[model samples]
Target: MKIGIIGSGMVGRAFSIRLAELGHDVLIGTRNPIITLGREEPDSKGIPAWKFWSLHNPEIKLATFQEVADFGDVIINATAGAISIEALSKIEKDSLKDKVILDLALPLSYSPERSPKLIYSNEDSLGEKIQRAFPESKVVKTLNTMSYKVMLYPSLLPRQHNAFISGDSEEAKLIIAKIMEGFGWESKDIIDLGGIITARTTEMYAPLLFQLSKIKGHYNINISVVSK
Candidate 1:
């Protein structure tokens, strides 16, 4: 499978490297590949993301966003939530037609008090917006509830944890679920929250996730749902 991932941030890089390692042909989409590859300063991880990926996972290729849209069979939107719309706008909606899109972006805003606020709350959600924007795309909201590390390697936590999926298309969700299972997530670990509207619930969890990280002293935690 050829996977096109938008954004070269940590999430995009992690997904790219892991999927490439899993034998998928991966293409990382960026506004400017040259600029991304030329970065000298390190990111939060203390090394340039492109440089690290090139050295460690050279199988993944870098290309313009348009090229990514053309190359991918399945596209993953891992861009920052705040600029997701702007980033995706560069690609023609027709180019994304009928493709399954795994949307992991969460719209978050920080206040002067330092508390995070949801840009799209109960009335709206980034997932729904994306679906509306690209009516032909099968948009599934997922992987927003956990960090990049925990997303691909849930077993690192030792305890069982859950990930949520919300989208209008059952087939699209199934495709994404298979990918998640390939990443070591059990079938039960994936919970389909029903339709893209429910993305509001998952997207709203961002603030709580940050609070939990502060309380737990690490970002390597996830929610485990138990029901009979």
Candidate 2:
């Protein structure tokens, strides 16, 4: 599979490297290749510069937002929540048509306050918005509830924790679920929350995730659903 991932952050790099290792063709999409490659400073989260990361990762090529959208058979939205919609706007909607979009973004509205607010209401979510924005594309929201490390490696948590999935198309969800399986998520542990609207439920967990990481001093954690 040829996968184009938007955003060159930790999540994007992790996916690009792992996906390339899985023998898939991978290209990382950014607003500007030169700028993305020229930055020497670490990101706010202290992740190393993309330029530094790219040198060690020659297997994954880089492209503009539009080129990636055109090249990928599957597009992964790994951009920051605040800029996800805007970043995607660079792509022609026609290029996104009928492709499975594995969306791993949360709509976070940051203020000076400690806790950032979720942009969408319970009736709507980033996943639903992406689906509505590009109705022709099949959008599946996954991997947003956890960090890049845990997302690519669920066994890091121990004990059967889960990865939740939400999307309108069963086929698209299956495609994403398969990728999760490749990431070491068991079929039984990958929970389908149903339709894009349920993305609100998963995404709403962001604040808890943030607080939990702060409390635990790590992002290597996850939640499990237990029901009879």
Candidate 3:
């Protein structure tokens, strides 16, 4: 299976390496592949993003957003929440038509006092906005409620935790659920919240997740859904 991931950041890289290792062809989508590949010294993480990819996951390729849009069988949007819509606008509408898109972004912004605020809330959501923008694309919202590591490897922690999938297409949700199962998530652990509109609940969890991480001093924690 060919997978195209938008955004070359850590989240994108994590998904790329993991999926590629699982035997799927992965292409990272970016605005400028050349600039990203030619980037200088590493950031605070100590390894340049491109170098990290070249060294650790050479199997995963990089390309422009358009190329990736045209290349993938299923597209994964790992772009930042703030610029997700803008990034999606770069891809050709026809390229995304009838394809399954796994949207893993949260629309978050900071207030003047540096407090986190949701860019979209209440009646509106980023997932709904994306669905509205690309009506032909089958969009499923998931994996935005936890760290990239946890998203890819749920078994890293001993206890069982919950993951979510939301979209109008049951087939799309089933496809994503299988991918999650491949990533070590139990079938029962994945909850289908039903419809794209439910994406608002998952995306809205970002602030609480961040706050819990800040308080706990780690990103290892996750949500554990207890059903009655």
- Least lDDT summed over 10 consecutive residues: which range in candidate 1? 44-53
* Candidate 3 residue spans exceeding 4 A from truth: 43-47, 111-115
Error of 2 at 82 (Å): 1.1
Q: Please, what are the lDDT tens digits per residue for candidate 1 over residues 138-202? A: 99999898888999998989888899999999999999999999899999879999999999999
Against the correct fold, how does model 1 do in TM-score?
Answer: 0.94
Residue pairs whose backbone atoms clash in candidate 3: none
Off-target runs (Cα >4 Å) in candidate 1 are: 43-49, 111-113
**TM-score, per-candidate, Cα-based:** 0.94, 0.95, 0.94
Model 2 bad stretches (over 4 Å): none
Per-residue alpha-carbon lDDT of model 3 for 100-214, expressed as tens digits? 9999988888675754789889898889999999999999999888888999999888898999889999998998998888899999899999999999999888788878988
**lDDT of residue 227 for candidate 1:** 81
Candidate 2 clashing pairs?
none
What overall lDDT goes with each candidate model?
A: 0.89, 0.89, 0.88
The superposed Cα distance between candidate 3 and the true structure at residue 179, in angstroms, equals 0.7
lDDT of 3 at 126: 89
- State candidate 2's TM-score: 0.95
